[model samples]
Target: AAGAGAAAGAGAAAEDVPEVERESPAKAPVARRRRTVLLAGTAVVAAVAAAALVVNLVPDKGHNDRSGKQSVGTAASESVDSSPDASEPSGAKGRSASPSASRSGSPTASAPASVSASRSREAAAAQGGDGSADGATAPAVAVNPYKWEDPCSQHYLIDQNPEQVPPPPAEPDARGWVNALGGVAGGQQMLALTVQGTGKATVVLEALHVRVVEKSAPLAWNDFEMGVGCGGGVETTSFGVDLDAGRPSLSPKAGQRDFPYKVSESDPEVFYVFADARTHNVSWYLELDWSSGDRHGAVRLDDKGKPFRTSGNVGRPAYTYPLGDTEWGRNESYPDIPG
Candidate 1:
């Protein structure tokens, strides 16, 4: 009986122990897992919020970067538009004026002077001054129409054997003479006259008058060796004719010989006279008279059929007339002589 009672007492003691206390180990692990899960969920939410905040910060930098690029683009466009050295023609006028103000010694110095004058006129106009902008600008000059002359129509019969004529006296004051004899040569006749200007200003060739003189007149004779194979002797006379007066005369003064000839810039004027020898005959004399600036001058052919300036100076030949034979005939018809 006493042993049964002790066992009962021990069983009661075991029952008296708390049920929560008995399951504490397993329940503590479950509670720790739940807390871990909650903590993990909170950490995940913080990471997501941090990523969103970083994304928001990135947009600001991106916006600033885009804005900077746009500003740079705008500046580049402005620089290009206002560039004085731009090649666009539309900007030429503006560029011409600006560079003169900021810089000097450029090739556009002349442009600046003109621009300053235009600006002064504009300022005067703004102040209600009498300067008219339109009047301040020079009017455009009219260009003359280019008309080709028919040299073949001016052909005349001349003595091919000019050596038969008597030579002029040895005295410098004595005049020479010329005579005409009929002859024909089978060859091409091509004449080219080229006039070039080297000055920085425009050259005006006003009143270009040409005339043909007969061989019966007294001319200044000079010994000229013509290398052409026309069977004509080389002894020739150097003479000058007044193209404007349509008369043969002696050479003029050196200063007077350069009259009516102006050269500006580098443009060249070319005149051509081509004729097949089968149809046309060689003429006697070719005289040229022209006016340039305030001067007038005349040119004529020497005895050797070469044109030369009357001044007898040898630097730059203001005018050149080269005559030669053509290997092939031109198909174009010659125009009639002008009235």
Candidate 2:
């Protein structure tokens, strides 16, 4: 019975060890491993979701910022293109627009204002009333009124040797008198005379003589004279001859006489002479003596032919010399005569 009791105690001690306690050690390890795996999976899922969110948010924000910049650029470009005054000279426009663009950082806002300001400045400069140099306006240059007209268009010459003296020879002689005094009075005379050489010069007409000659012999002679009254008069008693001195004078019967006249290289003075011829039936000739400063010269014209011929019809009661045979020559015509 003591042996039965010992077996019973051992059995009781075995019974005190619970079935759950024995399984606890093996199951605890498996449960703890599963819990650790679940926590690690949850952490991995959270990290992936966070990474995706950051990627999406960052791109969207960047895209929005880029879109804003593009919109601003487009608006600025449009404003610059559409502005009315923006077409001004590129340099000026650029300068003006720079300030506005720099201040506003918007192309649309600054370009037009800059262009307008530039235009205003240009307009002010053009008007010349203000915003100009010294407040003085430029003056218009004066033009010559007689530039296109012939100055020596109307004039004539007459033989003025004294009637008492014998007439000159038909052709020029060694004396230089007859040859020197032969030609139409106003024929081919210069409307403006060109004074050449150096220094200031004075143009002076010395004398005039007219005579009726037949075959190189004098028929009638008359010295040119001047009278108080100008224009038409009796041939023998007209202004061609001086009434007081009974001699000829170089001064023109009509026209300006101011001498030592200022002249330019491009423009010169023209001269003319006038006289009366109503008397003789024979062929006639004219003699004109002239001096300019130190230069002395003479011109002659007759009724015969070129380089020495009368232009006006001698038979006519009154005559005025044309410009074809004057001292300047036939090449000179109206308007070609320089100022």
Candidate 3:
């Protein structure tokens, strides 16, 4: 089964930092994970990433007590890059400097929200600053990015003052709450993408690659819970990455195919990527390789125009505004999601 919540963690900072955002998909949004990777390992684990993202907590008193983390994809046109790379993708730990990207061909693409800046520069520099960080997408077949979730999709808000955060209503606007506070998604970062060929041609999705733009010490921030509960199964071509690994690779999950799928305007394929970090806050994105007829190219998927971020928030001060609760309280317990 899959978890919920869109996530992007920032590196350690002195005090208040602006939040960024997370998503877009044209084909299908697989069940947006409510939990992070720890919970996705098995339902019995519940969303360990939800309440149990054991990371260093922010100091009890500071500006971060009122700041939020960055999220992704609030606005943008859905289209393939103008110039596509014909080379195959290598979404692995040892990826080359060459870059790839994916875009949506429609304006109706939807995604979840979260973000980071210094890491952005690092990612651009690592990629040789060839405009990949500027959101200048190339042209190829159309593809959608982001997992499936609504405005109320569960998420974690780091280092926000409980006093300023409004009380939870009957149905708390999770996304709106995070956005208002400028908090980022904590724990794990999950991504979903819809890829297809153009016109009547069937585009072959050769491979999906992973690139780590930057890595830093995990943020030490107070954890605010948005996860109400978790329920769902992995329904797409699922893959996993361990951000803590010396060389992380995009390995297929249990019972999941690696890549090499087929799609077209009439037929599209959706992929779910689960990434986790145990020791570092990481900035990353995906690259895809597609070919139709004699023309083939690669596409890069990121958070709006920046690299998506995620971190391991383990034992931070976890809090929640559970159902029926008017005020935010300590997250003393977690749910046991069925596998």
Candidate 4:
């Protein structure tokens, strides 16, 4: 049986054999050539990978900048060596000492010129008086205007008179300063120009009901940066009087004739006279044009340029010169008016 099976297998194998295999022993060489081609391909791939890795591992070269570094080389060393000397003045060896330093020739004779000059300036300032031209005894300016004279230099408005009124509700010791507006009777409502030492000035008028209203500072004071407001009260509005106008007139408005105040001009000075309705008495107020050499003449003229007169209802006590009787100052000159 085994011989028969072997004979059958040989017959089948002979039948399956291809014509190409039967003709050649060249299969081994073909396989070897294929393996050689595969090896060559692998070598090329590895060489390309190695070249890429080399490029990635190495870095490019660049410029060497020293300026950004804290310490550069020889240049920096030279700069460090010369820096301190360069800080000195170019010709420092020949330069003289400042005024504060004196020569060594005489030790005790050398005064500190700077200190001496400072002392002299201080002495001059002390002698020249304070910021105000007036010496130290200026008025106690509880409430005062800008252009007011030294109240201390001159006597006050209300001397030790029994009739002197005390300050209003808030302040008591404050003395009544002479109102800048003269010939104003103690209680009369008059328009007044008042000033304070703060470099401020204002115009205020007392109305019929004793209500005070502040008026605009004249354009001049506003331009000068002076303050503007109605002064606190009667005692605050101090002034240097132009007392020369005596037997002053008191005029009232045409409609309100009962109250009287004076309005008149003597060259550069203008006066306002009024009645102190509280005391049922008469008084006067004077206003001087400090800038003009004479009184503001036009103020005395009516709108129609008529000589300004007190209204008829403004009555007089038939007594002589109430305000003139009070002492004003050394240089003040009183005006003469017919009673």
Q: Which prediction has more favorable TM-score, 2 or 4?
A: 2
Off by over 4 Å in 2: 1-251, 254-267, 290-297, 301-339
Ranking by TM-score: 3, 1, 2, 4
lDDT of 4 by residue, 82-155 (tens): 44444456665343432112222225312222232233334435655222232111111111111212111111
Residue 263, candidate 1: how far off, in angstroms? Answer: 5.6
In terms of TM-score, the best-performing candidate is 3
Residue 323 lDDT in model 3? 77
Q: In model 4, what is the error at residue 63, expressed in angstroms?
A: 7.7
* TM-score between candidate 4 and the true structure: 0.15
Q: Sort by lDDT, best first: what order? A: 3, 2, 1, 4
Residue-by-residue lDDT tens digits, candidate 1, 89-183: 66455544334333432333233223333444455456565233223221111111111122222222123323442322222211122122221
Model 3 residue 136 lDDT score: 22
lDDT of 2 by residue, 219-295 (tens): 22222111112354222211232211223243444433433333322333333333322232223444444444333
Poorly placed runs, candidate 4 (over 4 Å): 1-24, 63-339
CA lDDT of 172 in candidate 4? 23
* TM-score of each candidate structure, all chains considered together: 0.22, 0.20, 0.52, 0.15
